[model samples]
Target chain A: MTSASKSLTAETLIVQEVAPRDGLQIEPVFVPTEAKIALVDALSAAGFTRIEVSSFVSPKAVPALRDAAEVFAGIARRPGTVYVALVPNLKGAERALAAGADEINLVMSASETHNRANMGMSCEASLEAFGHMVAAARGTRATINATIATAFGCPFEGPQAVEKVEALVARYGDLGVDGVTLADTTGMANPRQVADLVRRTLARVPAERLTLHVHNTRGAGIANVLAAHGAGARRFDAALGGLGGCPFAPGATGNVCTEDLVSLCHEMGLETGLDLAALIGLARGLPALVGHEVPGQVAKAGRPCDLHPAPARKAA
Target chain B: MTSASKSLTAETLIVQEVAPRDGLQIEPVFVPTEAKIALVDALSAAGFTRIEVSSFVSPKAVPALRDAAEVFAGIARRPGTVYVALVPNLKGAERALAAGADEINLVMSASETHNRANMGMSCEASLEAFGHMVAAARGTRATINATIATAFGCPFEGPQAVEKVEALVARYGDLGVDGVTLADTTGMANPRQVADLVRRTLARVPAERLTLHVHNTRGAGIANVLAAHGAGARRFDAALGGLGGCPFAPGATGNVCTEDLVSLCHEMGLETGLDLAALIGLARGLPALVGHEVPGQVAKAGRPCDLHPAPARKAA
Candidate 1:
């Protein structure tokens, strides 16, 4: 110890870029399909192996992604990339397959009340639909992942029972699905709960088959992800600018911010192959694209360490 | 298994609250000393074992905390509670001593540029001052802690070299201070970085003498805290509402919200005797105190697994 060495470990993490889909969903403006394509192309060039490009919801339900097919078809796909799309039901799955989505992500709220409110279906129906989608996509080249919404907690139903999550995971595990994602859709996850659920989910489902898709609605999204990782999860779903929340939870902020997540993973020595400067540049341009100020801090402030005094006060 | 049987990790994590001092510093409004007192009193009754009540800095520097003395004197101090006051220099230290602060927290930015801009002193000068204060405080029955500000990253300087943090800890150790607090003053820390730093810092500084003070500036604050805990750190510093930020750094949010932090730790099976609901109530009342909506999620949204909508919402 030459008195200068102080870091305990150099652990690396992966960052899945979700700006194209989740980040753009909440914007009032419907970015031109070409703009969405450019964003995807830029992110792909910036070394994102996995990027969620669009959703397969009805054009009217999420008008922001009305040109989802156009956007996906327009993007210049890099050879080694995985392009994921969010699918709400069989229609979404069918549309996503038609749009050439490399991966299909299906979500089911753990709470019945939220499930009805979000997808306009009961939990049982959602699971039944999931089974169908899984079966339909079985022979396709695309991988399938299930997101357990409100895995942490929910406003309408209160905290989700862990048994509900376990049962869902078992179902997904039995389906031989590519993966399962646990979401704190309304941000009600506490660290211990997150750790326990992820741990149990991981034990039932392999770590490689589990991902965490958390929303910062209650500000515990990242904490829950950390807890889940502590309980053994390697994949996660995050949005740039922390955009995209349940349509049912109007005031809830979107998923965890991508740049913030990437920064965390990069700083921890995780190998998230994302360029900080490039992500910041991408994040800064998001406001103009979406027609509102985004919630990403790194883009507005640059990296945490880039401190420069404003030039307005320095005429002398 | 029953529905609740799957939630892992029981018990609560100690959430050391720091809102009275850190949360109020960045706001323009000069919260009344009496209000600070009331807040502290309520917080104590609400069950915070350690509360950072006020800061003994120059009124010209942080006008928001000019009444540190009155706030300290006004709160009804509980027998087992530890009341902490932040002190910047000899004058502030003297005032804190006079105010009967149970503990004195000394803070210095790890980056030289930040140290110069925030405190108008070099890190060396701050360390020397810390040594002098430690010597002067020898007879007083108060604990002393040195917080390395911008330990993860700085606004002025980009990535804080881990070596810089180690040097500061070694110096703090030499000064015989009670603990070392690694503060992500700008919330630039990621989980991997936090874990790595915690691991490295623990080798030089014992876990019992190390504390983590995180700001949720970029939404990674709580995640970083969990990462630190995973690396074996126990003590944490957080604000009630996630209020306040550096005036110099526009758009930066404040410290980690206490309610969310406590809930995260509690769910992780840690032991901290804080009531989650009580902390959330305090967080809910903070918007009016500062004339803006503070950024905490759980206080406004409720915790994970919390199924009860407020009785009013239920009635509605």
Candidate 2:
């Protein structure tokens, strides 16, 4: 009935869970290793096809996820659940590979200034390093995926040029990565920008190989996801309890919430193969785990299908 | 570049400010009458074409806005700006017209159970009352608008039949409302549902007379707005600082934020005719007035075009 509904063809949408890695990385207190494993296992059991378990960065860099190795080793590997890990360089890639990561996700900023501030290197240098890292894991069991951080806009640089993002996708495709994720590092993406980038990126990479990662920092995260989905891009990265933020990006908050996205997709008649009730249960545990309230909403406001009893007394 | 983007052609989107009424109606403490007048004045100077100043309901019914008449009398009304007031019955409508309201907004719930619970009357009773209220305001200089609350879904009734909403809208048209607003009272709305309802409603109403009012309860407020905008809904109702929630709806939160929506529209290349910087400044003052934090994002995150300085030291 609408252009957006008409543009969407695929019935099933892929939701890649990134709570453990992206969500907890910015926390002041480190989550217990067992809790990390438990969170990933719960997400896996809740029907997530892919889960970013942790990152293989230096403990000094992100002390919260320092127990990445223990977390990976402790999780009960579900056969269908592909475990993913973020890698900064060849050393991190090797660590992740040794920890049995099914997919190694590499990230670089689309904005040169953000790249310099975040990775302590130039965009050219980061791509060169990624090329070597991809070659190193070419014959391994791990599939590689490159993420263009700040693909929508940068905290240090305004809106990124669509041509630069498309070129980055092309470069990653040429580098022989299994997939690519366009990351809105600070929730700076709008739905229109997302649709434009997703449409152009799809020309360079197949739908199955592209992921849209967004944040609800400016309240357009889910809208951006809807735009990408309408443009035929399916896979999405969301954090459980809407936890996650870039420490380097001022005013950055939660990523597009997992349960909320699943709820919206399910309501729109899109299959996410997820248990919304179970996801809500896990989200309800986030505040206690992080010692603060999380930004997720569906956990607080039940699904639309969840009916309430009539009020006992008349409301004024 | 994309279907959704192509669907948006009107360069300027109308933002109807509902903060003075919807936002403060649910507040625990009453804002001073002078403060309310100042807010209305500030919002008028900020270029809002329409502002819901207050409601003419009984003081016992909505004590927060008890000084509605005083507030209306104290403000300096601007030219080209419509000052609206919510009227529950013929008496309320008369009161609003006597107080010199530019537009009288009448509201009824689409869901029968919600209507009964919220208004302490059936949908038929509310409609009958609105008929009289509309008739009362017809000969006056004030324009009349009818709002269908819980148009998306009702917490007590669940998903409302689109046919039922259409019937209500058609009935409102027959009663001769100058315009109509479809409100997602508790934010139980998704992008697809919004697109469908908006497209169907637009078939019965012209683009200029239809307004989409959504809340950020489940984090789909902005997305729903985007969907409606794509479906040819040019007018929208937003609360400053994302303030406002239905007291009858158990888990209700803030309405779609004014500053966040404007920031998004500007970023998406849509004109709102409102000042983003001025709106953000007003939003920043919400905490002091309400004695708590608000749910707004852009007030904290800044606009996407807002850039940050490079970190002095490299971020790890």
DockQ of each: 0.29, 0.55
CAPRI grade, predicted model 2: medium
Q: List residue ranges in candidate 2 displaced over 4 A.
A: A1-9, A248-252, A313-316, B1-9, B248-252, B313-316
lDDT of 2 by residue, A197-312 (tens): 88888888878888899898888889889889999898899999889865544444589999989998998889988999999999999999998888788888888888888776
Task: Give me the overall lDDT of model 1.
Answer: 0.77
Q: What TM-score, computed on C-alpha atoms, does each candidate reach?
A: 0.85, 0.95
| Residue-level lDDT tens digits of model 1 in B1-316 | 1111122122324567888888888788888887888999999998877789989988877899999999987889887788888999877887898899988889998988788777777778888888888876779988887899989887766788999889888888889988778998878788778889999998987665678988877777777777787787767888888876765557767888788777666655676677778888878789889888777767655665556432221110
Please tell me which predicted candidate would have the highest lDDT against the true structure: 2
Task: Tell me the whole-model lDDT of each prediction, alpha carbons only.
Answer: 0.77, 0.87
Q: Can you list the residue pairs that collide in candidate 2? A: none
After superposition, the stretches of candidate 1 with alpha carbons farther than 4 Å from their true spots are A1-14, A26-29, A122-124, A131-143, A158-164, A173-176, A195-209, A230-232, A247-251, A305-316, B1-12, B109-113, B122-124, B153-176, B196-209, B308-316
Q: What share of the true interface contacts does candidate 1 keep?
A: 0.49
Instruction: Evaluate model 2: give its TM-score.
Output: 0.95
RMSD of each: 7.1, 4.3
